[model samples]
Target: MKNRTAVIDLGTNTFNLIIAEKNEGALNELVHLEEGVKLGEGGINKGNIQEAAFLRGMQMMKHFSGLLKKYEVSNYKAIATSAIRNAKNGPDFIKQVKVQTGIVIESINGQKEAEYIYGGVKSSGALSDKTSLILDIGGGSVECILCNHSELFWKESFEIGAARLMDIFHKEDPIPSEKITELNRYLEEKLEPLFEQCKIFKPHNLIGSAGAFDTFVEMIETEKGNDVDLRELKTYLFDSIAFAEITDWLCTSSHEQRINRKSIIPLRVDMIVTASILTGFIIEKLGVKEIGMSAYSMKEGILSKLIR
Candidate 1:
């Protein structure tokens, strides 16, 4: 019989559940599920998980627990990131989850989160002999990693995630130009160390792992009238020119307009603009010539470890 495993990533904005079986030293995926609970909805920047967010998280976990049991996963790991790690009631929430759903939750720090993201991206065949930068933008944190195919050169997780940025800078439906400038300036200050490292490593390839990049790729594919199968795609080359155009459209569109778009999901409609701005900023600052998107990220990273 195959050994079944379930890995749950309780992210700030979305909770993801990935179930797989170990077979011949490899992982065969059984199920992949995502729930947008918005765990950081009203309290991420304030360093607390709000009451509504807490209830939403608990409900999601209960649902995920049911799925895990249905799959009969022999081994399971539930890991929480950013919002939970920084929240004041995070520990209490974990205790409650264990008591209520019989699922132990482990809250990992930003550095470990970055490592897992790197592992996931590496498994997707994104790494190469030449240096490359891996960027994973989550709801509460953005992980940046510099590496080649073999080893990691540098990695860091910034608190400036899309949800956090949205909360701070997206007061207007269509964010004002002045607000964007402020946001960029804030990012430049926080990412000074990353920029310095970029100068030293000179990594020209920027690989985006999961989250907003997935939506970006979908949007791009739709615009081109292409019938690209996203599941079969391990890596996608992101056209910078097209990315710039998308960013402009996102910044000018209202909430209603964004919701009407097929490419933009309901969960990401509000925060996608901030994500786009951040993506464009990094491309310009790093002088990145090539950009690729990796569908695999933290959950896959966990699976890789278990199978190995």
Candidate 2:
């Protein structure tokens, strides 16, 4: 039997599992699964994972452990980011996972998380000599990396994620324009480091890693009636004009309208509006010439290291 490895990403909003077998020095993907645990649901922004979210995360981890056993995985790594890392009960949760499931969960810092995400996107071969700004928006935090094809220039992780933003600024169902303005101001304040870095490095293109970008691509494809295979796509070029249109709709649409859309997943319905706003804010702030999406993210980044 070949070596099979499993990688579990315990994200703030979703827990993702990827099983792959090493074949002739490369990783051949065998399984991919995602469970929306919403670990940041109740009070993650307040530095705590609420009781319900904690229980949900535990259940999801147990389920992922079962999948790892079913695949007879020889090596496995589980990582917790953002919500778990920032929460006061984070270490307790990690201990419970190890004691109950015998799976040790590593809680990584934002800077390290950005590094792994960069590794994943770099593996996609979408990058070039020109500096590209890579963005991975998770539930509790957003990882930003500036890099060319060869080396990393600068990287930072912001805690102003969709979940945090939703909790703070999304009191209204369809967020009020004033609230949007406030959110923009908040982003500008929090993202000053990124802005300063952008001034120096001057990354030309925005490369969005998984999560929200996936939904954006799906929504755009549904609207255009295009059948692009996302799994096979190394990188997707997103039209900035079309993205602006989508963001506008998301910001102005009600809960009923958003949830009814086939392209919006149930788990993402509440948070996508904030996500769209954040993406739009970044694009405008950076003055990016183009946008691209990479389906690969943290899991792939881990797999690349493991296989090597």
Candidate 3:
């Protein structure tokens, strides 16, 4: 049998597993699984993991562990991001997972998370020699990595992610302007200190590394034209007008409406509003003309490390 590796990424919103093996010098997937855990649903401000959230996470872990055993994938690594990093009872949750699922989840820091994200982008064979800025907005945090000419330069992680922001400001359905204002204030507070430090990076090229970013790119491209090929290539280049239009449409859309209109599932619909705002702000602040998308992330990072 061919050797295989499994990488599990436990995020605040979902637990994802990528099982693959090297073939012809490339990673080929054998199985991929994603379970919506929403581990950070209500676990941030109070700095605690709620019982319901904990159970959801545990159930997902149990399901993943079963998949691993059934697939007989012995080589594996599991890492938890923002959710675990923030919760006061995070350790307890990790311990419980290990005991219940036989999977030890590593609560990785932002720097390591950035490294994995970089690996994922690099492996995709699309990164060029430009000031590429990679933004990964997860359930509990946002990670920013800057690279010049495919060389790593600087990186930062903010405690601002889709789910976290949703819990923070988008509490009401069809969020109001006042809430948006409050959200911006919160983001500004966190971003202000990083401005001076971010100056050195000089990143003009924009690349977003997450489902939210990818989804936005797809949405804009589809709306502009029914051309799938054209959409895939240039979806990242969301202009100011297009960004505003999409944001306005999504804000007024009920979760069900967004889900049905574009096949956006219920799990993701909740974060659509916050994600749009975040993506728009990132593009505006960086003055980026285009934003790139990559399917690679922490899961790719874990596998790369294991292979090395």
Poorest 10 consecutive residues by lDDT, candidate 1: 226-235
TM-score for candidate 1, residues paired by index: 0.97
lDDT (CA) for every model shown? Answer: 0.90, 0.90, 0.76
Deviating ranges (above 4 Å) for candidate 1? none
The number of residue pairs in model 1 that clash at the backbone is 0
Report the lDDT tens digits of candidate 2 across residue range 58-164: 99888888888888899988999999889999999999999989999999999999999999999998789999999999989999999998999999999988999
Report the CA-based lDDT of candidate 1 relative to the real structure: 0.90
Question: Candidate order by TM-score, highest to lowest?
Answer: 2, 1, 3
After superposition on all CA atoms, what RMSD does each candidate show versus the true structure?
A: 1.3, 1.2, 2.8
List, residue by residue over 215-247, the lDDT tens digit for candidate 3. Answer: 666577677665444212422445657767877
TM-score of each: 0.97, 0.97, 0.90
Evaluate residue 207 in candidate 2 and report its C-alpha lDDT on the 0 to 100 scale: 93
Pairs clashing in candidate 1? none
lDDT by residue for model 1 (35-123), tens:
89999999989999999999999999999999888888888889999999999999999999999999999999999999999899998
Q: For every model in order, what is the number of clashing pairs?
A: 0, 0, 0
| Candidate 1 C-alpha error for residue 195, in Å | 0.2
Error of 1 at 281 (Å): 0.8
Candidate 3: what lDDT?
Answer: 0.76
Score candidate 2 by TM-score against the native.
0.97
Candidate 2 lDDT score at position 194: 93
